[model samples]
Target chain A: MIHTEQLTKVYPGTDFAAVDCLDLEVGTGEIFGLLGPNGAGKTTTAGMLTTRVIPTSGRALVGGVDVAAQPALAKQVSGIVSQQNTLDRQLNVWENLYFHGRLFGMGATTSRRIADELLEQFQLEKWAQASVYALSGGMAQRLMVARAIFHRPAVLFLDEPTAGLDPQSRLALWEVLGQLNRDGQTIMLTTHYMEEADRLCHRVAIMDHGKILALDTPAALKRGIGADTIVTVRAAADPEQLAAVLARDVAGVERARVADGAVQLDVSGGQRLVQQIVLAAERAGADILDLSITEPTLETVFITLTGRELRD
Target chain B: MAASDVTGDVTTRAVPARIELQLRPVLTASYSALGALLLRDLVVLWKDKWVFVLRTVIQPFLLCFVFLYVFPKIGQGVGGGGGRRGESSFATVLVPGVVGISIMFQGVQSIALNMAQEFGFTREIEDRVQAPCPIWLVAMAKVLSGAAQGALSAVLVLPIAAVVHAAGVHAHLDLRWWIILTLVPLACIAMAGLGLVLGTSFEPRNIGLMFGFIILPITFLGGTYYGWTTLSPVRIGGFHWLQVLVLINPLMYVNEGMRAAFTSSPHMHLYVIYPVMAAFATTFLAIGLRNFRRRVLA
Candidate 1:
């Protein structure tokens, strides 16, 4: 549904390109996540794809139309929910959606009908007659989504759809996105939250410094590290002694490091490794106060590849 | 036989559906989209109907009453044409001037001030620009709405202004029907174009500076209290430099056009008024469009 080849955008008076040579494709009816830290060019890429910002070089196509050559066509196929809330604060919730539909050439009656349905679907029917200024942050974000999809565009581009929302609100928004994808709308979203990407996206791309570091499904990206579990053991004595013993005893230990008075190891079979590592620690006259075996998460994958935490 | 008949019906229905989709009438759809944007703005104004109406009528009404009626009643004369034979009374002379200034200020306040806020912290303009039309059309909608408001202000202010104080002011209002019909819209358009340029040029942070540096000067020197021709005697030895200075002000033509339409006062010649106003409109529109495009892209 969307494709880009070496897409780049460099703002005037800036040295480095905001979006540098990004090669991406989002298939029809799939939720693709562009995961990156703040200022990592995800929003710039989405802006160029939506034709809100002209690309400095490269090509993009949305629904078989070249975006640079035929921006209106691309706009017709894609709806954008920018990072900033673009809801009309002066207008009521229903009026905002109705005006969006009208901009896409729907008649007044049809626009109101579609707006009403979307409002109901987003659970915003109670706020239909309420001005946007009266809405809470989560309600306003949901209204922004409703306004974007009121035209029924084939592809939806959401730039940080869940930023600043509480956990419940983020999960509710993810459910809405999942339902939209199941109903055959292609979705492209950018997010800094690792769990959002893991739970929502069918395919995820990790980007930093205007570059895509990696791309794959959440499970596949995690599995690419080859370690299924992380074993962390708290030590009463020096952690270096326990780390040395674990390094000598555990065969499947891929990496061992001491942090916060705990010997943490990435291993293949965490259950067996935990049993053996605890025995080794007790024999070394070190008390194993606590032990935890965790499944490898996106955070570990990101740290292994980039050598930094996603938030950092 | 029954299955074949159902399949034939479905195929026949699909063929026309494909044809209808193919012939979907592109230009009309685009025009309708533009119209929808225009109507959307108008509807928003309508929803705030009382506020808009009060905003349009109140300021001009107060200015006309205080400056034309109450001030002269308290023995403050506005013009030097009080005792001349063919000259108009102060109220007569000030009527069109008040109307013209009101329209100009209305355009600036409604269009420029509102644009500053939209392009400020709220960034409501972004949603408007996201409409399916070209970016230029979005800017045009702003100008059009401002012009509509200006026109409405002109209509609402004239009658209240005309009948406010009638005792010794024998002001003959020769409302040239043709001039009123043609020039009011032109004046509104010109003022709206100027407003557009001002709106895009001033960032919200420095809007107070814009009024101090630009709007105040334009209002005072815009031939609001006196005719442009009347300023001829205050020139340098052989040059009408004051009149020439006011030429750069778009409100000069609006006031001149009002003079020609409302009273028998000697005013700036029609030939100069028409072309100068047209030139100002074109220049402001070009600059406004360029600035709007640059800002939106940025």
Candidate 2:
């Protein structure tokens, strides 16, 4: 649904492109994530696609319409939730959404109907008449998203949709996004939240310094590290002894170490290996205080690929 | 993710039908979008009606009250200070100037000050530019809305300016219907266009300088205190340099236009007022829209 061909934007008087020669594609109905650290040009890429920032060079197409050549047409099929809150503070929640619909040439009645549905969907019905300045951060963010999609754009670009939110509000937004994607809306979200990308995006592009470093499904990206699972064991009696026992007895235990009163193991097929490690700990007379078998996360993939932390 | 066919059918059936039924016939989609943008500003202004009225009326009221009423009552040097005739002529000149300045201030307050805030760190303009119209149209909406506010300020200021005076210093308002109907709106729009130019040019941090260097000078030289004809006396070897110089100030024409519309004072000729105001409006709008687009993209 969204395509770019070496889409580059070098701001005036700058030596480097904000977005380099970047070729990317997002298929219809996919929830794609652009994962990166700050100053990684994620927002710039989204801005180009949304027609808010003109590309210094190259081209972007939204729903097959060239953005620079026919910006109004591209705008018709694209809605952007900028990293900053851009909701009209002078307007109330309902007015914000309704006006967005009207701007897209929707009839007043249709706008009202759609705005009502959006308010209900985002659970903003109670605050529909409330001024934007009166809303909490979470409500304001939700209202921004509602205004974006009020016109039912074909693709929705959410730039850091969950930044600075409490855990509960972030999770609430994730559910809303999931439902929108399920409704067959193509979504491209840029975020530094590793867990958010892992949980929500069907595919993610790890970007840094105006370039894509890695792109794949979260599971596949994590598996690319060649470690299927991580087994961390907190042993009450002796972590060193538990680590020794697991290394010797647990099959597929590739490596083991003890730190912070815990024995961590890199193992293949940890579901099965964890059971053996647990049994071995019991036989070794070391109490297993806590144990977990976790697949490597997107953070692991990001660090391995970029040699820098997601937030760095 | 696949949407159900039932949902798809409903969307297809309802969206276009509602568009046809509710949107005004013969209105292009662009016009409706522009109208909606202007309407949003009006709604916001309406919500803050008391604040708006206070801001609009206080300055004009004070100008009229001080110069027309208080100055004469206190035996101050104003209104030529000769007799009833002198006081009345000064009232005629000051009334239009007060109305003119009010319109100018309205344009600046409604558009420029608001633009500064929107373009600041808040970035509210991003949401506005996202409206599915050309970027220029977005700036045009600001001008149109600002013009409407300017026109309203003229209406609010005029009666207060006309009546709030010392007993001897009464404005002789001609109430020329043709000039009032035509000139006032054009003058409002012209000042609004000027507001757009200034708003987009100055940084928010330097807005104080806009008033210090630009607004103060424009008001003082904009024929608010005296008619353009009065400038002929303040000359360099009969050059009428002050009169010639004030012509470049857009508000001078607006004030002249106001005088033509509101009083029978021997102001600048109508031949100059109408065409010159038109040219100023066009020039300000052209420059303002260009600057607006640049600032928005920047």
Candidate 3:
């Protein structure tokens, strides 16, 4: 549904490219996530494909149309939900969808019918006549998604779709996106939320410094670390020093490093690993302030690849 | 593992992607999209029609009320200073002048002010420009809608301006239908095109600079308070610098066109007004569309 070949974008007066030689393909019927922190080139990549950002060099195609060369055609095939609230405040909720239909060439009767259906489908029927201002954030987001798909775009691109939502709203959006995908809509989303990438995306590309460091499914990525347990520690001493000590002392410790002001280690041991980590901290004279063990996540995969946290 | 880990993940969902719609050619699609964009603007205007009427009438009404009615009643008539005849003649000139100013102000308020909020306030333009059309066409829609509002303001303000005078002081209005029908639309489009330029040129927060530098100067010097022929006396040694300088203002052509349409007042010759007004409209719309494309794209 989407393809990019060495797509690069170097903004004027910048020392480096915002997106550097990104070669990517998003197939039909897939929930693909570009997982990265701020300044990681995710949004820039999406912008290039959407024709909002002109690439410095290389080509991006959406459903066989070159985005830069034929942006209007690209727009016909791809629907976008920007990171900001972009609903028209002047129009009521129904008019927002109605006008969207009109702009896409639907007749007035057809526009009204579709607008009613979308309002009902997105559970916004109660607020159909109300001003958009009256909606809560979650409801507004649902309306945005409904408007996006009203034209039945081939691929839907969402940039940080759930960045500032409350937990319930975020979960609701995840479900909404998941439902759309199941109904045969190709979806691509960019997010810094590791859990969102892990739970929602079928495949995720971890990016930093404008390059993809790793790309795989969440399970495969977690298993690729080759660790059964992940132990995070906060110590009184320097975290890097404590990480060094634990990496050497722990028996099944495959690797260790400091991320987000804490020491983290990937180990292969069983249930006794926590006790062994405690013993190692005591022996190294490290006053461990906090310690926890959990299974590896997409975040651990990112840390293993880049030596940094996903939220950094 | 922690308690949160136990409730860790949700089931993932995926399905095949399918899209089936017979899209028309690019130009056809853009044409309807452009019409729809204008319709959206019209619907918004309709919803606030009462406020629109009030906004269109208030300024022109007050100008007529103060200049034609109150000033003549208080014996402080402008340009005449005394008799009912002189005051009545001033009213005739002022009537069309107020209509011209109304068209100009309506265009600016509708296009430029709304653009400031859309571009800067909430990024509301994000969804607007995403419509299935070329970016410049989106801008043309705004110009078209603003022009519609300007024309409507002209219709609303003319009668109000012509009749609001003191008793026994009546202004003669010789309605040249040819000029009125052609020149009013031309004046509207030209001014709305200027609205597009000013709208795209000014940033949202610094919009005060738009009025301070562009609007106020256009209003005071664009021959709205007097006819263009009257500016011939304010010259230096046969230079006619003031007359030539006001020619640079697009509103001068609009007001001059209005004078030719509404009253038998002396104005810039018909030969100079139409083509120059058309040229101004074309030039402003071109620059405005360019600025709009630049703003929306990057």
Best by DockQ: 3
Candidate 2, residues B1-298: lDDT per residue as tens digits?
A: 2668877775554333212212222235567778889888888899999999999999989988888888888888776667777777888888888889999999999989999888886789988888777888888999988998888988888889667888877888988999988998899889999889888999989999999999999999999998888888897886889988998899998998888889898889999999999999999999999988887663
- Model 2, A91-128: lDDT tens digits are 88999999888887878899999999989988899999
Using lDDT, give the best candidate's number: 3
**Which has the higher DockQ value, candidate number 1 or candidate number 3?**
3
Root-mean-square deviation of every model: 4.5, 5.8, 5.6
lDDT of 3 by residue, B30-122 (tens): 988998999999899999999999999999888888888888888884855758888877877778888889999988999999998899877
Model 3 TM-score, 2 decimals: 0.95
The residue pairs that clash in candidate 3, if any, are none
Candidate 1 per-residue lDDT over residues B42-120, each given as its tens digit? 8878888898878777866776677666666665655453532222366666778888987898789878888888888
Name the runs in model 2 displaced over 4 angstroms: A229-294, B1-27, B235-241
Scored by CA lDDT, what does every candidate get? 0.80, 0.84, 0.87
The better-scoring model by lDDT among 1 and 2 is 2
TM-score of chain B of 3: 0.92
Residue A300 C-alpha lDDT in model 2: 60
Q: Give the TM-score of candidate 1.
A: 0.89
Worst 10 residues of 2 chain B by lDDT: B17-26
| iRMS (Å) per candidate | 5.4, 5.8, 2.5
By DockQ, highest first, what's the ranking? Answer: 3, 1, 2
Please list, in the order the candidates appear, how each scores on TM-score for chain B only: 0.86, 0.89, 0.92
DockQ of each candidate, alpha-carbon based: 0.31, 0.31, 0.48
